[model samples]
Target: MADDYIIRTEGLTKQFKGFVAVRDVTLNVRRGTIHALIGPNGAGKTTVFNLVTKFLEPSAGRIVYNGDDITGSKPADIALKGMVRSFQISAVFPHLSVLENVRIALQRPTGLSFRFWKPDSVLDGLNDKARTLLRDVGLEEFEPVMAGELPYGRKRALEIATTLALDPELMLLDEPMAGMGHEDISRVSALIKTVAKNRTVLMVEHNLNVVSDLSDTITVLQRGEILAEGTYDEVSANPDVREAYMGTGHD
Candidate 1:
């Protein structure tokens, strides 16, 4: 909230029984910028995400979004505030056509009662907007394709389109490049850049190359705490980060 930051966490910490997974972390994600969270395994990158998304509650700390305190808010509550997370507990029906998947997402904000139960024709009115979203994500050609049948990278694109349907001001992605081949990685990386033009993106990704190329700011974690924070060059040049990755031999 301070100085255009869309989300900020102060003194964030989490523990399981007696073991701490995240500790006294303070992070700020600037609006309309791509921020990456990176660390070796067990560094608590995912835990920080889980806490922010409200999938897990922090043992101590506060989460602020757009200058409002949302630490005690529910997952749905934060999502409604335009902080939609990719892989957002929203299910994409595998059997549905890609367009249909996006259409469902487009219908989410209506708060209509059992609207999905209505006849399929009832959704014709939304096709244009859904198609526009498809075009926005480069999934226009695959609109008719079954979501389950699309190639891996295109499927990720569709998932992004669905999230975009909610019109989020801030987007959180958990491993946007996970399980991607070289080609898919490039494609999805480009798509993420395109989609992030007017929106803020916060992602947890292991592909440091993608982070190097895409992140406006990078935050590095180690043993459940922040070790480095800066642009790609700064974080990559940090001796502590080099030691954490190479000395510990964690990929």
Candidate 2:
């Protein structure tokens, strides 16, 4: 499926004031591929995510998703088109039960117009679906627990489950492994691999080892531009990437 890239960006850029946060970064994330974006601090990795997810409008360039141009589309509109993002921070409702959190996300896609009448059957069906999602992320045990009370990793898993409710074709994850301990990281990594089996994932991560393990392709960014892009070995072997990783006077 290399020839059928699900997401493509052509000279995509984002500028804030006089500073360019993302510069002419063209990329192709092949269908069903796990593409990892890695770079040092201030390398504009998160900015690229922002641009791709429509959280920030691009200053220039075009974005093609499933071969359709969506460069300037609004975030909600883009999400409705089967592209969704999971932020670095958890977006789950703190007060809602774990199952309810996922249920709310499921409700978004359905045109639920009848609010006054009791939705007993609808609620039951949604409950079953939400449980399935929780089970997917290994959070089924905490379905009745308050979302805010779950462990850090479990909270993150809930967030991912909520995102899954959108049934996204392309999922943009910003540092999914952020703030996780070794055990938590391992769990999340497994969950990521499971989810990626059916959805295309493009993640920005700082852990090189994790990137190498999870990515079918890798892209290195520096100062708001793409430094290199290829498989782990190909990009790691690139002279520019080595220099970027080594930093000045370190090599």
Candidate 3:
């Protein structure tokens, strides 16, 4: 049963000048499921994410991934272990074409990341795989377009495509649907679902509807600690969750 969990944290805590940002939080992300973390502003969602991904060190805690204690691992180390985090903002080379951006991402796994001096033809071998990722994210039509020229929503889709190029086993998405209209949200939501079929996803999102639709499990945080966690229906019905998350008039 231990193998069922891809990542787990025990007594995770973080502090800044004696101010506790995350306190004794324990989380278990199951293998092959979409897990969501949601909370109000300053609820420490990002802090927890940083800690888990090893961008920030925990003051007290242990992070275990695939049965290994990775509490002391670096960000790149964790990434090499198949846990990769996509940034909250779109991260792609503006000057590059959409296909180029994904080709660069694919280079890392092929030992070509720092070989900038290599002829462009050396990267041509990566184009087919990059195009496949673009098609996977529904951006094949825009492959030749400048990444900066694409609309905002499409940029996010491009970002996802690049992340997928890394071949992450567990993808950590930070607000994958942060800024988008209804249509973009719908498209990206479906893409997330399709990509999740073979890999696990752990996302921090503010959109309750998106969370409700995609998450197999949800964890609610408040004041740097877990307030409630369960399926959407279970947490939505809790009186405390209603008061804290949905507010008094939300019913």
Candidate 4:
């Protein structure tokens, strides 16, 4: 049987100079599903992601992934364990082709310097795998195009392809749909759904429509604490959740 939870945290907390950013926040992300973490600004969603990824040390908490304690693990350690976080800060190579960008990520497990010393013929073999990832993200046609020249949404797709090169079991995306037009949103929403078919996804998105459509589970936070946790239909109907969203315009 599948593990009860792929990722879990108990009493997770973060303090910034005595100000609590996230406090006593427990989260459970089941294996093989799309889970969303959502809240208004300053509600500590990203902070929770940081703590899970070990990007920031939690003030007090235990992070367990696949039933192992990872609270003291480093960022790379968590990544190696199949938990990868795609930062909101962007991961695309502005000057490289889509194929080259993905190949670079594919070579990460193999040292970059070693690849540099190998024959161009051997390096060319990475193209097939790169193309497969591009295909998965619907960027196969753009493989030879410059990553930066693609439209914003396509660039995001290319970034997602780069992340896929690592073959993560649990993918954490921070604001995957941050700034996009309706067309881009549709394309990306479709792409996210496609990639998430086999792997688990945990994303922090402000788009409630996407949340409602993609999430199997939703955890709502307000003022650094969980206000509600359940299906979209369940949480959206909660009076307290409605009040929090209405008061802060969370969606």
CA lDDT, every prediction?
0.88, 0.86, 0.89, 0.86
* TM-score for each candidate, following the candidate numbering: 0.95, 0.92, 0.96, 0.94
Per residue, candidate 4 scores C-alpha lDDT tens digits across 115-222 of 646676877878889899999999899988988899888888888898888889999999888888889878877888888998999999755566887889999888
Clashes of 2: 0
- Model 2 RMSD vs true structure: 2.9
How many clashes show up in model 3? 0
For candidate 2, list the clashing residue pairs, or say none: none
Once model 4 is optimally superposed onto the true structure by TM-score, how far is the C-alpha of residue 194 displaced, in angstroms? Answer: 1.2
- Predicted candidate 2 versus true structure: per-residue lDDT over 130-152, tens digit per residue: 88998999998998899889999
The candidate maximizing lDDT is 3
Q: Which stretches of candidate 1 lie over 4 Å from their true place?
A: 88-91, 247-251
In terms of TM-score, the best-performing candidate is: 3
Better of 1 and 4 by lDDT: 1
Global Cα lDDT for candidate 2: 0.86
